[model samples]
Target: MSERSERIIKHSNTFLLPDLGEGLTEAEIVRWLVKVGDVVAVDTPIAEVETAKSIVELPSPYAGVIEELHGEPGTTVPVGSPLLTVADPAGAAYRAEERAGSGNVLVGYGTVESTGSGRRRKPRVSGVSGVSENVSVARVPLVISPLVRRLARDGGVDLHELTGSGPDGLIVRRDVEHAIAFRAQPASEVRPSEVRPSAIQPSAVPATAGQPAVAGVEARTGLHELRRTPMSGFRKAVVATLTRSRAEIPEATTWVDVDATALVELRASLRTATDPGPGLLALMARFVVAGLLKYPELNGYVDTGREELVQYDGVNLGLAAQTGRGLVAPAIGNAHTLTTRGLDAEIRRLTASARDGRLTQQELTFGTFTLNNYGSFGVDGSAAIINHPQVAILGVGRIIDRPWVVDGEIAVRKLTQLSLVFDHRVCDGGTAAAFLRFVADAFENPATAFADL
Candidate 1:
């Protein structure tokens, strides 16, 4: 549990959404597990809500008969807003100081005081096989995360067929995603195989005023025809952070092209059948860490309230990864202490977790600087946006073979472009340029650059 907020547990019949710490402000209700008049025990999962970082099952802090639910599915509820009302006939569980359990099960929030243990009911079984109308014969699969269940349910993927990749045969989000990708088919193609001939008959759908005329695709002019998806809490959080960064930080950009033939050859020589050695990005990250240590001015953020620039002795390297939800930059804490191999392992782990939408709040916060490998998207360059609070972000473009002048002779060399965007208030162009030059030089001559380390 995080120690950011110190508010007491709700002693009244109404239970507000608890503070999901790490500066998270709100969550979107994915679905409610309990309805009005349902009896619930303390710590019983009442709803599945999605915060900016991940989906969470919100446990009930009060155990009683549920009287009313405050919000519906798909509604956004701010932190500290009322979630539901419970009617305590005995009036014992609603006391602020004598609440059962520590209420410390949730990812971020904690209780003011707790006694007695909480009760939890067993999860109800649901059908996961697509081939069956009845699931009484199917075995219960081990699934823990509500997000994973939601993904599997939405994509029509059969969870029984998948082998869990997580601990103790726990089916994770990525397992379902892999199944969905492998089993995905067009509706027309899938219907013939999965549905009976009698069930395949097309039913007449009413032609609504703003609905599309064609079955496959249509362009309707009416305003009602426009598809509008509500902005999610994740997207909202991103918008708020980027908006704040743009409004508060004075930013500048600097870039340089480097001939990275030596670095490329160096990585290739280090690779063998048993071990692939450190990844190219890991080598670059090593260079970035070294560069930051050499120029500490570009490694920290400016404190607006204190009118001071807080520079840290260590680095938390943020790697920008594109996930199904959105762009997330999960940081590697104390990256300055890690070797290229260590960075490689952490990068791979974080990248996989980021894509699967399983990163924790701690992993997603407190990034000091960011490294974006937009090169994987097949782009040459980007004057990237500065991640809020952090002063700079470095983007590496696609590494490709290009003509270069080597000892006054034209030669083909592996070349790439590096773009650095930093806060202008934190450092002048000369400082930013020098930092960029240091990284570029490292890329050009890995042996010399690494020797200094």
Candidate 2:
């Protein structure tokens, strides 16, 4: 051992998880990059975590040998929980010191001060009565003991409205029992004005809120075991986004079937054995870019807080890729200025990166409009959900052979379906129809469309 290691008494230092932004509360640990015995530098990436927004690699703040890893892979960890322990020979002062943002590791992140003991302790609860000595009045109910907190939770007591009877306004078990008993009284015994509004209502409490499972119901249904999966991480985020979209936006869908024989032939004529020119999705994306330029209302997001339609001068085209994690939409910035081949390259790159979980925050979150080519799954058509707060999304279905009219005669031709889902707040049905028709006309007559390009 080195001279500095010989002087240290024990390893009491620990590193806590930092706050990842965007209103996220917890993250799932995807994997750990370092093992327990590995030495790490101040900026070494130690673990990869999957947040609601994206996958992020967390860096170490202290230079030391790793002592312990707290959570296992695939486990969801809260924001302030211990990530790992590090033993440094620099003594207690260095271990207790906090690491503020250095503009590189993470913005608005800092280390939590260690309590100078090897054993972990319960984090101090703020906004409590006796706990906050600097403040004159407590803003929330205060209970220091875990037993008292559990009593309030299990009894369905609203601690926020309760006035503590203990010294310095500390809440005790007696106060919780009183609230629980008061709620149990008959309705005729309680007056309207005497009833206090609880932060947690009895009916709103969860089935597993410090309570046992409903035993008889499962037995009656003949169910022996229940497999439960928590609604969290990326899946939960996607649900929240779609829920908000449905609740807020007045959306409408318009679709059209087109004879794409000309568009298919155009690609075939441009390709050699070695070079495939541009893909069908890329050609469709180029046309969509042109359509958005004509119908700018479709290429923007709603500023709900300002109650304004914030349209952009350029398009950030998002391509939705299905990965193991879920469907992720990564956008190409300023896509309007790119050529057909450039769009093809970007779409491929983003699709690969998204599938590998290597997409950056900016790529995943900056789309003004989205394009989902669900035809890769060999489907004909779908009414896709609009990726909010963007006003519109365009989907391309599988191209197949079909009978169509040409020169007033029926003939076999290549055909495809196009669908557009748009926010009615931005444009009327006429505008959305016109935009969809523009793309459909381009697909039917690519030579005419390429002349403009």
Candidate 3:
């Protein structure tokens, strides 16, 4: 077929809303960044779309003047529905010729033709979309992925001048570190301090002569018109999840003190011998998993709808990581099967991914249990709420030297408090207490607990 014939047959380019989560078929258009007659380039952010998973920015695929915006903000469009149309009649024909010759299309620049009008018959309208014009908007120009952009915004890092080191010179976590390191260097070797004139004193003007007669008090206008922008996709998702968890789960908490001296000593000894030893957090995670194996009821979920306590055979431990956008719980799959070193490696990887906003849907979902390490923040204790459906969450406190009784004598020992929160509907107070006790015991004598398991 002639290239001109392909061009003539090609119709308008249809931009569809991609699936944002586990087959999430629809999403609400949060806002449009461009208007009709505005020129858009491929990969330029055209609109903000909110899905059940998160709020995401949709980029344009075809470079042209925006022909039309198919839906307004707050309207939910199906996954394959036309979000907007770009004037790309000639580009469409070129795509067909390339596809026929090479059997492959260019990335992020090709168009997917629609079968019909590609508009949903019924659009959903639940939440408000769009930003107020009064808000102070800052334009950040950074060559980074959407995930990296989200991460940088949350971390309060300026991305304008940072050099990227990823594929195609894209910005990544390491690039951020490099920027921080570069800025931390001293400006010069011998910097002179500014010396102020201590002896010189200025003559004060007489109160009556220096003060000019005040005219009628001038009125000043204040920034009284406040504008509130709707939450971003990620922020909205976090709120929805936390709200659902609080509403559906009947959570209860219990706290216990553990002598963590043994665990600490073990970690120090192991680090001296091993090149890269298991960190304290990883060692504790292993002990926690072992404890879960002994107390299987704690490694289960409460299905309130069906009135069933669903016990999981595999243990996937979710680590609650604080990210720039919000809290994210990314799972270490089959944590029970991993050794102390293995668990540590996986936990580090997962947490880094969570902070970078690179976690997959599966990693963020289906966690059998959760671990919140408040100790990282030097907290002694906190009662964390159980993540919805999951029966239990474990919180770790900071370890400190304290007075304790040993052989009927006062002695100094390293102690840390452990908090266990569970769904009261699925497990009782006694079970929660016993489970924490078991964890404490395993940490005190990890060799005995992990010897055969």
Candidate 4:
């Protein structure tokens, strides 16, 4: 916050979810880090929400007691909506503390101070003062409580579709609870073959935001009928990114079977002499970085609108890691400056964070190049989609025993396939092929290729 904006004083304040950047308009609450009545400090992470890009932890803007939470986990919320309320008795001190936050800018982003620094909000009446004593709240309408909304979401009921029976036609918990019971009643009739146990029924979960049930339509003849898991925000973003990459970039794949016997032997020799050095992927990463330096054109993106190639000063190497959650690629900043061991440690750390679902927004994006080791999946060669905006992606396949002719004699050697997928707009086939060749040569002769390191 700026100096002028941080001087405002008030007993209570409402925090609204801020724009998370990258044009993402909504996010689903993954978990709550803080609860009501908890005393929190400025910039304290209050909740974790999964956006289209990554999972982010929202920091609180005020130091005070948490008055209320505005939503529950698994519920998607739009930006600029109330996230929570905080009550601070010493508003002046809290306002001062707000100015001293970590450099990471997040919630309570925009600050515009009104004329009066001591402005307060109008309080609502605690009791009915002008109405009949026996009036029922069922007559109300609109502006329902967060708890009521959460109940409706859990029960797979759409509050907007039902007519509120509360005072002023306001929807309450009871209304949503009744709707759940109403839907819980089975259909008038059911065939033994069509009906499965309730545990396997996909209808329990809503297909869309408001409509309940992922309707199981029986096709006349096909084997596609089964339960379904709707693509989450993460999964959907993966689809959109891959789809856009395929549509926009004209990509080509080329692969070569490389004798990795020398690379394996190099690592084995290192393990005996020094602290078991970085993994093979780290050695491959070192080679990739060196290759990019030799062939810089393959390390950039093409700006279609401006008609130019945008080259980066340093490499942010993205590691494509697969976890139980889904696919995620967290970048290692300034990979060009790191040693093989340093790169290995960084990769391990990011992989742990990715698996734990704790990777921040920065770690999940902004990569100049990507290295995908699909070998761990026991697959050989892949014509992968270019992680959009990146000119190329290199994939490594499983290393296994294979026959090779060494100086006219047949020999058994450990071999692996190296595949490269590159955007045609940035460079031609010659440049792309050279880059892959450089990497493959490094793998075949690790001693000579990595001698400089």
Could you say which candidate leads in lDDT? Answer: 1
Q: How would the candidate models be sorted by TM-score, starting from the highest?
A: 4, 2, 1, 3
lDDT of 2 by residue, 194-302 (tens): 4443421232222344454343223333442333356649888899889999999999999999899999998888799989888888888999999999999999888
Badly placed stretches (over 4 Å) of model 4 are 1-12, 37-41, 89-214, 218-230
The lDDT of each candidate is 0.76, 0.75, 0.67, 0.75
Q: Tens-digit lDDT track for model 4 on 354-420?
A: 9888887777878889999999999988988888878899999999998998999999999999999
TM-score of each: 0.64, 0.69, 0.60, 0.72
Full-model lDDT, candidate 2 = 0.75
Which has the better TM-score: candidate 1, or candidate 3?
1
Q: Rank candidates, lDDT, best first.
A: 1, 2, 4, 3
| Model 1 Cα lDDT, one tens digit per residue, 226-345 | 233789999888998899988988888889899999999999998999999999999999999989988899889898899999888999999999888889999999999998999999
Pitting candidate 3 against candidate 4, the one with the higher TM-score is: 4
- Model 2: how large is the Cα RMSD against the reference? 14.0
Clash pairs of candidate 1? none
lDDT of 4 at 411: 98
Residues 1-453 of candidate 3: C-alpha lDDT, one tens digit per residue: 454445633645668877676767777887789865467789989998766554567899887656557765656788888888776746544545434533322122233333246421221111111222232212123232344545455544455444445444445554554443333334533211111122112222222433532221111322221223456555666676678878987888898888888888888878754376889999888878877887889999776678788888989999988876577788899998888889999988987876765677788886889999988889999878777667789999999999998889999999999999888877788888888998888777777766856
Residue pairs whose backbone atoms clash in candidate 3: 55-233
Model 2: residue 385 alpha-carbon error in angstroms: 1.1
